[model samples]
Target: MVGLGTMGAGIAETLAHRGLAVVGVERDHESLRRARARLAHSLDRAQGHGRLDPPSREDLLARIGLGTDLAAVADCDLVIEAIDERMDAKAALFARLDALCPPGTVLVTNTSSLSVTELAAGTGRPARVLGMHWFNPAPVMGLVEVVRTVVTDPDALEAVVALAGAAGKTAVVAADRAGFIVNALLFGYLNNAVRMVESRFATREDVDAAMRLGCGHPMGPLALLDLIGLDAAQAILASMYEQTGDHRHAPAPLLGQLVAAGLLGRKAGRGFYPYTAPDSGEVVGTGTAVGTGTAVGTGTAAAVEVPPVRRVGVVGSGTMALGIAEVLARSGHEVIVRARRPDAADGVRARVRTSLDAAVAKGRLSEQDRDGALSRLRATTDLGDLGGCDLVLEAVVEDLAVKRELFTDLDKVARPGAVLATTTSSLPVIDCAMATSRPEDVVGMHWFNPAPAMRLVEIVPTVLTGETAIAGALGLARAAGRHPVRCADRAGFIVNALLFPYLNDAVRMVEANYATIDDIDTAMTVGCGHPLGPFALADVVGLDVTLAITRSLYEQFREPAYVPAPLLEHLVRAGFLGRKTGRGFREHRRR
Candidate 1:
């Protein structure tokens, strides 16, 4: 071990308890003292719990040797470097170890963000050097990213994989990217959440609750952000931005401001929300520090924003449209739904009736509520009926031309200043904006596939779109009992833009045979606390949709990084669309 920090000490102790003698080296004596104390205290607790026998406890403690010299690691077959994430610092340390240790010693850096290739070059031993990126509190975190540079020896890679298993960890080989798998997927979503807060699309509570309740995330993004200090998040974002050059990785302004205020997360008693129990994420303090945009105090912002959505026009003839219409009616809005024809309107009404009836059966909707929802729901094939509506949302096809045509027609026909929005998953909103005379009224209200079931609705606004237009769209979405996240009009918006790439990467992981589907999903759900693994969620979110979004992102960002995996494209081409198609990542039975 290279350093006796929290991660290094945990790894050293884990190895020692596994009956592997560890030469734990630190730059100074004080860190060594702390690490030694931590190891002894940890073993004592384990012994008290009957997890460690007296003989084994003594043997394990005796195996860990504290030293300041890197020369002591020469006899060891494997030496893992757990230290601060500075490229130059890591490179220098690895170079010294390469000079001191035996040629056969597999040298590894516990670097989560630095380049493995650069570190290998610094050591002048490219074949032996690789990245052994471990999660925080190494002994407890089950997943480890075993990063391989081009020159890394296959034997060395296999050795580390076996060693990690021996240490009771599941290792996944990750390409030398900024965050590898978990953090890359995690931090992008976290940054987007901050962007939503910056735009005031919803309150922090709504945002967090939407994710927790709607998406089944272990922790809400805002609360998770507070746990991960702004400075720490900034560092990861900086690395991700350097790698992919996507604006999504660019940390939001509020993150820096909070960090500057010394509210660097739970460690400093605050970040996005004030922490009462520091790292525990329990609310102990009330209110947020006052700022220019939203000065939150007593857990609420001073600006009591009044939204304008008295009447909402819902355009669709599908299940999603009916679900959206149902939610709109349930939220006390007069919902006027438009279909392509009279028969299409009939089908929509029937679907809405069925959905409402089901809700009533589940006791989610009362007899009175269902009847009232039906009363608010009026279906027509004509767009002309939506003239007096406060907001008009077309939940039609996910095509650009069709959406543009609808917005163009709505621009001329709908009442003046009424917000015209499209439920486009991947189409550019600016294209729809340009089609309309009142571009300021055009926005994108992308609810997840199941509008009623999924809690998140990404509210997208182009540069030409007015504040009221944006706010009105979000207001109606929230009024529909949905959590709306405001985002700039981009290719994939927030959720899909950040989500699809990670899914594609998981496919790449599968392509390499890193782990089976069950292993990967298990690691993600059990290890990272995600509600659904990427592959399974990909199945729920159609493969065709994922492909379309990935292609759009690739075209917009011009980052080859966003290209959909060939495997994903193949599945889509094979007509395996997911649960809707009865087959996707895992085969499903047809109804």
Candidate 2:
């Protein structure tokens, strides 16, 4: 291993612990000493954790050699380059290794963002050069992308893959390109987060929480970028943007600003969030003191007293309405649901009863609790029945006109100062607010599907919305055990705004045939640690829904990146609406 930085040291430790005779090379004795010390610390930690016994750890360390000369690996069978990401430096190192090492020796580079083919072609032995892109904290992360250039020998690729496997890492092979697979998709998402904050769509904390709680991501995009080092992330993103010419891959302007200001994340003790010390994960300051654009209720909702919400009214008899009603009733609120027709109201009540019964059978709800919740919920066709509601949530279809007209009715029936909220995932909440007489009482309470199970609820406030309404919506979300992330009344709000574009990009990738559906999904899952790949998620969300959200984003933003993928439209046109129709980018079994 050449260039013993953190990644190089980790790689050295991984290989040594796997019983491989390894040599770590650095530019000078000081560098080599530092690398050795780092490896020792890591090994000591492993031993303390019982991952390695003392004798085994000593034996492993004994098998490793350190050197400061290129010729030290001349007789070795392999020379893996874990050097800096600069292409000129990598090319120069590879040329020297090609000259000094034996002709049969395979040369591997552990670069994550540079072009492997260009680097390989710089050496006389292009066929022997390959890339082994390992994730950070190499010993901890299981993934190792074995990148093969066009001129790389199949034997050389096989050797690297075998080596990665022997070192107990999951190896994924991809053609040489900027970011290969993981960083390609990963950085685009991260850059979008920066844009979200830069544009003030949401604050850093709320953006991070949306992905963490909403999507099950371990960290939010901005937090992950902070951990990645702002300068390094900007470099990788610049490389991807220059190579792919995709605006989505372009580094957010805020990233460059932060890097220039020396707030390069955990290393600098500050970036998106402030830290108490360098390399410390403990954040010190509140993240509300952000740049330009409205704060969007990120850090904490204001201290205003949330209006009482004992009696709640839900309009429409759709699945969303039933779910919302169930959530409200279970949360100790008297939920009155109004449908357009008596039969529709009856159907809504029946569905809610069935869902509660199933919950009881599954032991998710006790028999008494289920009965109590059912008694609190009532369905009616009379819109006047909602007159006594303290909070009225509209869970109608995703049509602006229909919602506007419903808001006009809700304003008249709901009592004075009643918080009027719309669960519109795609439409603008302001349109509904404008239709109501008291726009200050109209806010958005966008819930993810299966409101009872999903934790995220976007509390969107329009310009006309009041503080009390926002607080009430936030309070109601908390009452139902949901994580409330506040944002402006923008199209797609928090989750859908960030999520749909990614899904569309995945569709574009499949349409371009750059990779198969399985390859893309596997690359994201194995490479980025996403709970599910974009393609799989699109299928689960329904391709039609994905297309509608994508269209909404495009129509709202007018950005080329948000444009709906032709493939998505084609699939929807062909009646392949993902899991609902059992067919989409990938086939799914009918539920």
Candidate 3:
């Protein structure tokens, strides 16, 4: 292991733990001392976590030899470089390694974004060069992206893959390209998030919460960017943008400004937000916490007083509508579900009962509670039944015309001062609001799929929307055990606005033949901690729905990168609509 920095020390420790003899090299004696301390601290942490016994940790430490001499690697069979991301510095090191090491010794670079092909061309043995991109805290992360240049020898690649497997890490191969697999898909989303903060479309807290609760992401983009130093993120984005020439990959200006100000991230005690101290995970100040629905950094005025909500009405007969109705009833609100037909109304009751029965069987709900919730829920085909409801939520189809017509009808039938909310994920809330004379009463209340399970509710208010309506929506969402995030009425809102573009970028990767579906999926799931990779998620979401959302985004923003990948469009045209059709990006077993 060369360059004994944080990543280098981690990699060295990982190799030594796998019983491989590692010669760790640093630039100077002082740097070497720091590297040793870092390695020791990491091993102690592992021991504390019960991941390593004292005897095993000592043995692992025994396998590593630390030094500042680069010549010591001459006799090693493999030399891995974990140096800084500068092209000139890495190329110089590779050239020097090629001269000092034996002709047959395999050389590898652990670059996350730089071109592996370019790095290989600087070596005397291009075929012997490849990239073993490991994630941070190498001993814990499960992935290693094995980047193969065109001239990379097959035997050398196989050796690296075998080595990765022996170390208990999964290896995914990708062609030589900027950002390779993970960073190619990841940094673009991160940059878009910074742009969101820069444009003040949403507050930092709301942006992060939208992804965490709405999409099931373990960490939000801004917090992850803070963890990954802003300077490092800027470098990766610059490299990717320079190589791909895609405007979306360009680093957001706010990133450069922060770096210029020396607010690099946790290392500097500040970046997107202030940390409790340098290198600390705890954030300073109470402003960053996710609010129930009040506007903070958002330019919108503070929410008006939340109206009291008791009786609730849910419109539509789809899965979303039934889920919302169930959630409302479970939260102790009287729920009235209005379906278009009696059969659909019956189906809603039947599904809710099944769900409640499952909850009772799982001990999540007591029989008495289930019975009471069921008693509070009423399903009917008559739209007039909703007249007495305090809040009427529309979980109808995504079409603006359908939503507009329904809103017009709802405006007439719902009681005066009733909060009218739409659950449209991509359409403009204002369009639906304008369909009724009571536009001030209409707000966007987007609930994720499987509403009973997901806790996110994006509360979007249009220009004409009343503060009272906003407060009512927030109150209802909070009462139903959901985290309410406020954003302007825009296409895709917060989560989809930031999510689908990354998915589209993944499609473009496969379209360009840069990586296979399995490799790309593995890169994201194992490296970035995404609940599902882009292709797998697209298949689950349905290709048709994914394409429509991307289209809406493109139509709204006109970003070239937001254009739907032709491959995705072709699949949808072929009727490969995803799991629903048993095929999309990959084959699925029908249930």
Pick by lDDT: which candidate is best? Answer: 3
Models 1 onward score TM values of 0.76, 0.94, 0.95
lDDT of 1: 0.79
Location of the lowest summed lDDT over 10 successive residues in candidate 2: 289-298
Positional deviation of residue 498's Cα in model 1 after best superposition, in angstroms = 3.3
lDDT tens per residue, model 3, 176-276: 88888999889989998888777767777889999999877899998999999999999999999999898888899888988998988889898887899
**What is the TM-score of candidate 1?**
0.76
User: After superposition, which runs of candidate 2 have C-alpha atoms over 4 Å from their true positions?
Assistant: 287-301
- lDDT at position 60, candidate 3: 93
Task: Give all candidates' CA lDDT scores.
Answer: 0.79, 0.85, 0.89
Residue 431, candidate 3: C-alpha displacement in angstroms: 0.9
Candidate 2 lDDT for residue 4: 91
Candidate ordering by TM-score (highest first): 3, 2, 1
Clashing pairs in model 2, backbone N/Cα/C closer than 3 A:
none
